[model samples]
Target: MPEIINISDAEDPRVAPYRDVRERDLVGREGLFIAEGEVVLRGLLDSSGHRPLSLLIAEKRIGGLADLLERVPADVPVYAAGQAVMDAIAGFPMHRGILGLGARAPGVAAADLLAGLPARALVMVLVGIANHDNVGGLFRNAAAFGVDAVLLDTTSCDPLYRKAIRVSVGAALQVPFARLGAGEDALDVLEAAGFTSFALTPSGTLALAQVRRPARTAVLFGAEGPGLPAEIMARCAGVRIQMSAGFDSLNVATSSGIVLHHLAEAIA
Candidate 1:
């Protein structure tokens, strides 16, 4: 367990980074990301690649998190604040008292993430998914379905966003992920790596069940309204979840859950 440094003041310099968390999208860009809740914090501590800088929790909730606390690094500062102070610092009422600040180990590359995977991998690829909540939900779905890794194009929202991490229930911290450049070169890379890429869309050429089982599969999901780009669809096998015609689509996250669940069954 770590030493519990008490935080009585919301403006205390030691707790400065946590202030105005929702506003900090890391747009001005610090490599740091905050993980919320004990479940998410536990995920951060358990992940070998994501290193925690510090942890903060409400004083009243400390006892409830004893086992989770033991997993945090001894050197990491574990700040404990009272309820009022916690609410003041967060700018809202926080039912879940745990928060962890984490960063990816420096110099980690897409290739490195790709290289370590098992021979048969089931991955999710996202493009133009700007909504943090949706992005977070997709990550949660990916984690639930035992996805091997997640690859995001330039247009996707950062999975490390605080809201996304919270929505994911810490799946963002648990899952392996990497980013691709603006171009569609990643598709070619996937093909070279023996991945059978599938672009998911409502008008997809084949129903998901109809497609042959792929040994190493990567499913591409795009933004909610526009869906996957035609160029992207052209680059891979097109797959659709069989939904009723009256409705145009399922929520991106919900569709991902359905697709990945089916894929997981095939993977197993």
Candidate 2:
């Protein structure tokens, strides 16, 4: 069991990393991130690439989380505070009563990540996806479909963001993801790994159902409005989901789910 320290004051220095979570989220947390709610905390504990540095929970929640607390390493500090103090420390009414400070492991290179995958694999490549919700949703879809990995371009937002983690329901923490290095092309890496790259777009030359699933597949999705750049799509086989006559596009997250579901079904 981990030691549970009682914190009477909101200004306790031990819990400083969790202060003004919303504000800290905007400026960034150096190498640390705040994991909110019970579900996300559980994810933080289970994640291999990220480790919980400390935990802050409302005193009332301690009894309910006893089993979960046992899973935490004995060396990590778990702090408990009253409801008012918890709210004051969080700069809001934290109804969930659970927060964890976690540190990300050193980033893995895209080449290393792709090279580590098995012969039969499915992966998602995200480019210029800046929305936290979309990034989270993509991770959720990736996890649901058993994607081998997710590759993000430099312009993509961090999946470890608090809002993204909440929206993903902890999937972000479970999925293995890596970012492309400076000036590195996603297609180059996928192609080098013998993956058949598919660029999902409204103007795709072939419908998603028409193409047979490859032994190794990489589905590329870009930001919603602009969609995948024509140049990038040109390099990969263009595939599209059949939709209604009027709608030309779907939210990136929704598109990803649809595409991933199709790929998963194809494999099954």
Per-prediction TM-score: 0.95, 0.97
Candidate 1: TM-score? 0.95
- Per-residue CA lDDT of candidate 2, range 1-268, in tens? 6888999999999989988898887885778888899988898899988989999999999999988999999788999999999999999999999999999878899889889999999989999999999999999999999999999999999998989988998888888899998889999999999999999988899898887779999999999888888889889899988999986668889888988988988862
Residue 30 lDDT (model 2): 79
RMSD of each: 1.6, 1.2
Give the distance in Å from residue 170's predicted Cα in candidate 1 to where it truly belongs.
Answer: 0.5
**Deviation in angstroms for 24 in model 1?**
1.8
lDDT of 1 by residue, 1-268 (tens): 7789999999999888788777776555478888888788888988867899998899999998889888777889999999889888877887788777788645344556667788878889998999999999999999999998999988899888888988999898888898886554668768777788999988888898876657788899999899988888888888899878797668999999989988988653
Q: List the residue pairs that clash in candidate 1.
A: none
Per-residue lDDT, model 2, residue 23, is: 82
